[model samples]
Target: MVVDDSPFSRTLLADSLQQEGCEVVGEADSIECLIETYRQCKPDIVTMDIAMPGADGFECSRALLAHDPKAKIILVSSMKDEETEAEARRCGVVGYLQKPVEGEVLKKVIEGVMSPDVLYNNLQSWSIDIFKEALGQSITRMTKTTATFVEAECSEKNISQGITVVIGIIGHYPGSMILDISKESAEKMAEVILRRPAKGQDEVVAMGAEFANVVGGIACSMLNKKDKAFSLRVSPPSVFYGAQTEIASPGIRLHCLYADSDFGRIYLGVGFKKGSVLWM
Candidate 1:
């Protein structure tokens, strides 16, 4: 089951799950619809939104859990932070995913619920060692705000596979991060972020550029956490043309792999070092 206000999100999420051979039993646009559907279907898993017209995903999950404690609800939204994640955890939600939903991420959520051992192992091994830990104060701010989410898209690339670059920014204080990708990777990102394949070939590239910009603004705000005080500024994003371009900056770069997608070489760059172009 999926509960979201956007018909686009519902269709995209359902299509992606179906492609992975998972059965999506029902789709609901509001809390009332979800409650009614839940009474009838009792789906094995549910992907719900944080914000809704009447009763949000959180409230609906709580009501259902009141009847059956073992319900596995996954909170899915464009919002991310310690506070939001903690709230979902308190509600007994099994997992949390940031928007926009991608096939690999959705599959992982399902598999994690079905198999606890896999999730535990991944959690244990997932390290914060390589990435720069944003300042303690900044992290604290992240917990209090509604801005901890990103939406990135890449442009088209002739290369069959793609690369993801995560770039971090640092000022007199901690700043933000950016994940740059090839145009093809960006479009694929759009397909994932928007949760659907391109209706027109041009949309992927166009939307992807906007995705990077918007995601950067959101991330910068989230990372700063003290936006009212610090007022950090985001630099304009730059696009690289070729497939072989590397993130050669001195900051840390972490490589990641995505399932079911050909975008190869995901790089996570950390910190905006001194002497680099610093946007106020």
Candidate 2:
């Protein structure tokens, strides 16, 4: 299956796949149509585009995975930034190919996606310890204070009465990492970073997003160093401020780490895809 907003790109991709001796099962120009088309075609693999009219490929991938946890979806996009690719993985996409992808590369990616060893290798690339180290380093660099890791726990409750900044992780391993801190803590951190009193809610939220970005970037670097095979990328930080902000996705595992600092308590939440087991 091929899903893209552009008819030309869709046709081009389909033709390439066909030339590679793969059957082009179905094509969709939008996310809504793709879901229905997927049901009808039941394709073994789907090549998706990032941009669309209504819902983008990220949202569509999430919907598809919710419907079928084992869906093998690969994103093909011209916007090949680390942020975009990371978000795609968080949406449960199996693979990613940048724009102007070669026919041989696409064929190889499709074949690799079907292999059990490749899937397990991708899953094993994620490390909670690396995540913790990255977060600690980021906090120290930004705030001049070392964050002490207290404990990590699996939780079903939504974050309430605080600001949450989320960064999606992509590439071989797909997941999400969230930095959850109270408004007061956020303001304090913002004040330290800005060298001024943080007054408004917007300022605090922005600081929270920056915190997530810094941590995510460092984490990706550490992960790549450990195993280049992961090809990890991180999405831009997404900020949310309110009481009871739910960050739940069905079939995804959520692991929350509590770290204490002089400023306040910081919660680092890591959400992994269904098949990837969380190693504490």
Candidate 3:
């Protein structure tokens, strides 16, 4: 299956897969449709886009993984982020690929994962020590939420004003991290883009998205290079303003609390859905 919001991307992926002598079973432009298709067709592998219309690839991957822990989902996107890659592993994905993907590369990765030896080798390649190092630069545990989640309860305090970013990272070597904070958090992050404070909701989302972008980018690099590459793909960050409901999945949600003078509540949840061991 292929899940992407861009019509051009979907067509290109389908054509490439067919050229590789692989069958293109189905395609979806949004998360809801992708889930429905997954239920109907249990394809051996899935190549999903990082960004989508409604749910996005990250949310879609989690939903699919929740239903089938061993689901062979590959994240294919232009947006590369460390947090996204880390989340993909936590989500139990079988593979991850970057955008402008070549058909040969996709074919090789798909065939490689099917082999028990290759899978073992890939797993051996992922290292946690290196991940800490790569992300260690701006890595700080959050006690409060960073303007990502609508409403987040943290060790330091509760977020009430501004926007909240709620993100879930799922995979082996796994976990989920939510950055909850206020509008102030978004404003500070905007400097990276506009060279100044963000002035509106659009600016805030862009900044917040960039924050996710950085986290996901670093995570992807670590996952690909640490020891060797394993199947991992990070989804684009989803940002929402105001208070929202609790988002849940089947994996062991690990929350990391980082709070200080900068961003507010940053909660990260670490969850594991051991391969071949999940009931759902």
Q: For each candidate, give its TM-score against the true structure.
A: 0.44, 0.57, 0.44
Candidate achieving the largest lDDT: 2
Error of 2 at 208 (Å): 0.4
Give the lDDT of residue 251 in candidate 2. Answer: 60
Cα TM-score of candidate 2: 0.57
lDDT of 1 at 155: 26
Give the TM-score comparing model 1 with the true structure, all chains together. 0.44
**Cα lDDT, model 1, residue 208:** 41
Per-residue lDDT of model 1, residues 63-83, tens digit only: 878877877788888888878
The local distance difference test score of each candidate is: 0.55, 0.77, 0.59
In model 2, the clashing pairs are: none
Task: Report the C-alpha lDDT of model 2 over 143-251, residue by residue, as the tens digit.
Answer: 8998789766666766545887888887555778888888988888899988999878887888888888888888878877764545568988778878568755456
Which 10 consecutive positions of candidate 2 have the poorest summed lDDT? 271-280
